[model samples]
Target: MRIALGERASGGSARDQVYLALREAIISAELEPGRRLSENELAELLGVSRTPVREALVRLRDERLVAIVPQLGTFVTLISTEGVADAAFVREALECAAIRLAAQRAGEDALAELQANLAAQDRAQAAGDAEAFDGLDEALHRSLCELSGHEIAWDLSRRANGHLDRVRRLSLPEPGYLGEMVAEHRQVVAAVAAGDPDRAEEALRHHLRMVLSGLGHIRAAHPDFFEEPAD
Candidate 1:
């Protein structure tokens, strides 16, 4: 399959370009889990040298997105259940704290921004624009974290939640899941607007728990797409 380089090569180094392209591919699931990635092939496809491709692969390996097999080749790393579970646990804890702070700190404008994001999400769902909904979902969550004034916490949450990015997109394909997610966001907004820290934390936790549960169901249904622990 021919890979399309969406943008023209800029003045940046080839390694940077390769890194950005490969990262995008992984995040969009264009590069399937466990798929082999040949250095020569990717270098040729990206019109870059093998050196840059190798560097990019090393960076991706560090991020746990790619694994190198001795004398064999490089392949996309299958996200392990244990890794996903750990990420979800950390994200839930941090986000719960974030929402609690937002309940106390979010001003009217912040609340309005969240409401606008919800409206956009509703429109995306109604129009069956899964991609747009995903973008809006991330934006809403980031906005909430920013409003809470927990910049460090937000950074940590974003990093930990990276593994779930594609999984969330998959979950959106399930029927009524998007609508339910929107409804959950509404509950969170209501709690935040009312300045009820306890309610906001509870709502946020419930939402994340549902998310983790949905991911578990997906993992069960698509064993090929997910990692299986060695016996």
Candidate 2:
């Protein structure tokens, strides 16, 4: 949402550009849940016409990142516990499978790269740079799928984990949470380096499930940002 539309989005597919910008803002909590949005306002913010903004809104609505109410307005969708659980399940499966293959095919070079990523994660944790830490998390996961020689799996995994991203972002505020995540990541990388597929898979599963396991605590602390499961 903070994109300077005139400067950045003037050349590319304006609708796709708008969509990515708004999606990043939503994921990063720049556009908080239940926040009101309007095509007119977004168009003005991005310095573009309303057409592309309207297109972008439609895509976001389909992703359930935004909700449209007739005669009311558009707003960011509140995090739903059920949706987070579902995304977490799919992400776990994909990542576990991917890590297994990575352990099989990974060479010394790939293992070394993962170690380098862990070193960066350590630095991010020490600096309290959650954004950098999260970025490194993605890099580490993507590196696993990349080593599997199935780049498309990483893309699919990313798309499937969309809902979980919101939950993960919320957990970043918890005390010592990021450091705990870094430790789990280190364990996974060490297992992969050992060439032990079963160990690697278990470690990856545990690492990825942290978001789901911590969901309750986050929901308790930020009740207004989430909708409870239907009885």
> Whole-model Cα lDDT per candidate?
0.81, 0.84
Q: Write the per-residue lDDT of candidate 1 for residues 1-231, one digit (tens) a residue.
A: 555455532457767778877876776678888899988888888887899889988987876778999988899888676767777888888888888888999888888889999999999999988878887888888887887788778778766664676577568888999999999999999999999999999998999877678877878766777777758
Error of 2 at 72 (Å): 2.8
Collision pairs in model 2? none
Q: How well is each residue in 1-231 modelled by candidate 2, as lDDT tens digits?
A: 464543323467878789877876777778889999988888898877999888888888877788989999899999877778878888888888888888888998898899999999999889999888888888899999999888888888877665789889878867999889989988998888888999999998888888888888888888888986798
lDDT of 1: 0.81
Candidate 2 least-lDDT 10 residues = 1-10
Model 1 residue 103 CA deviation in Å = 1.5
Question: RMSD (Cα, Å) of candidate 1?
Answer: 3.1
